[model samples]
Target: EDKVVQSPLSLVVHEGDTVTLNCSYEVTNFRSLLWYKQEKKAPTFLFMLTSSGIEKKSGRLSSILDKKELSSILNITATQTGDSAIYLCAVAAQGGSEKLVFGKGTKLTVNP
Candidate 1:
């Protein structure tokens, strides 16, 4: 079965601090890896990585994929209390249709 594992299950940081979250996966017929940030409600899309060595960035958030290693990393710069959330990593596999297998997620708490 396809599965994803995220490191440092939880994190605590002060406002303005930077954080890095790691995700590794083992799956067949892999299509892509996606990152999402979840706060009080549903998760919000962060990035989608299909090709290795390519970094996707949006403001203070960025992510990169390493296909050779079957892994990905999410980096958050200048985190604020508003940055506190659960970061989820999911892998899409090619089947009849694309299906996503999600990681447990890394919970980040940015303190003021």
Candidate 2:
């Protein structure tokens, strides 16, 4: 199945460390970019950047999309242990036809 993969697989950070989670994908007829934060429960939508919304930010988390490059990046600043979780990246086709193809996710661990 076409999919995405994140590097490092996991990360460790202190109470106030900046981190960058990477996501690389390979899907059919790429559509848009999606980012979610997974913490025990299902992932919660963090950002959805289509051709219309290519960049998004909320507090300490921010992300950008590059359709031409066929990749995206997510950045987090002053991360805390509460920020600890698996960050997931997904790709969905236009018109929302197929399921959201997901990456293996990057597990982030924050230490106090």
Q: Provide the clashing-pair count of each candidate structure.
A: 0, 0
lDDT of candidate 2?
Answer: 0.85
Residue-level lDDT of model 1, residues 1-112, one tens digit each, is 8899998899999999999999999998899999999999999999999999999999999999999999999999999999999999999998787689999999999999
How accurate locally is residue 31 in candidate 1, as Cα lDDT from 0 to 100? 95
Model 2, span 1-109: residue lDDT tens: 5778777699998989999888877777777879999999989999987774356889999998877667788999998989999999998865447788888899999
Which residue segments of model 1 deviate by more than 4 Å? Answer: none
After superposing candidate 2 on the true structure, give the runs of residues whose Cα lies further than 4 Å from its correct spot.
Answer: 94-97
State which candidate has the highest TM-score: 1
**Clash total of candidate 2:** 0
